[model samples]
Target: MARKIIKTNPNLIELIGNLKDKSYNEEVAIWKDVASRLEKSTRRRTEINLSDINRVSEEEQTIIVPGKVLANGNLDHKVTVAALNFSKTAQEKIEEAGGEGISISEIIEKNPKGSNIKIVE
Candidate 1:
């Protein structure tokens, strides 16, 4: 048997709803994928660090993280990162590197079709 996910955060619930709606309306698989990822329990969700982002990303790329972004290391290039949550230092580091750290809903609003968006774990 499978367990049902019980998300407590109202903001998260809203984001997931928006993601599903966007995916259905726009016929975009990426949004659906992100929504499923976000539906997981907190312990099962991803926690990516700046170093990993720097290693796998290129300058001026758009990356979406379904979970939280940590500030463990430094970022050397400019990129746009959208995630469900961002640590204070993580947001600061991205800004310091000339990058933008925004929310997933904002990203979906900016790119409804989810064009050229890369999912980072």
Candidate 2:
């Protein structure tokens, strides 16, 4: 038998609910995809580095991490990054590079239709 895991973080629970709701209302799969990724166990969740994001993305793009963003390398161009969480230094570096590091929920609220967004994980 498998044990049921309950998410205790109210914010996270709310975010997931909002994602699913938005997906249903907008008929967009991206929000559902992001929500599912976020529902995974902590160990199975994504932990992406700055270098990977930079390599997989282009300038002025909107990207989703579906997990945590780490400050492992450097970013040269400006972009908008939305993730479940971000390391302190990662957020700082993003701002320094003229980029914006925002939360997944915020992104969802900003772009309800989920247009032109790339998943970086």
Candidate 3:
């Protein structure tokens, strides 16, 4: 019998590998959890919206979206958003509202300890 492996995007594979490595080195549970979620297929992956971020996040929070972020609503306060992908409009909206849109790997490199980070899927 052979074990089946889930097929995933190349980018996601790299990202997941990095996340697992980071988790081992840093021993943080969040990184591992995020990687697990990201391992899912594109269809099942997270798809977060700006409105959801605005509703659930607080000022100066660092939020992670495991999937692409859609631009649908307004953001009242500035928050750091880390995601796999972001729509052009969503990126603009985030930047316009004094927030920053960064990739997951970028955020991981910046915050190895994963402090003050919230996964908003």
lDDT of 3 by residue, 18-40 (tens): 99999999999999999988877
TM-score against native, each model: 0.96, 0.96, 0.93
Which has the better lDDT: candidate 1, or candidate 2?
Answer: 1
Give per-residue CA lDDT, model 1, range 34-69, as digits (tens): 999999988889999999999999999999999999
Candidate 2 runs further than 4 Å off: none
Q: Among all windows of ten consecutive residues in candidate 1, which has the lowest summed lDDT?
A: 2-11
The pairs that clash in candidate 1 are none
Best by lDDT: 1
What does candidate 1 score on TM?
0.96
Residue 82, candidate 1: C-alpha displacement in angstroms: 0.3
Encode model 2's per-residue lDDT on 1-121: one tens digit a residue.
9777678889999999999999999999999999998888888899999999989889999999999999999999998999988999999999999999999988988999999899987
Clashes of each: 0, 0, 0
- Deviation in Å, model 3, residue 37 alpha carbon: 0.4
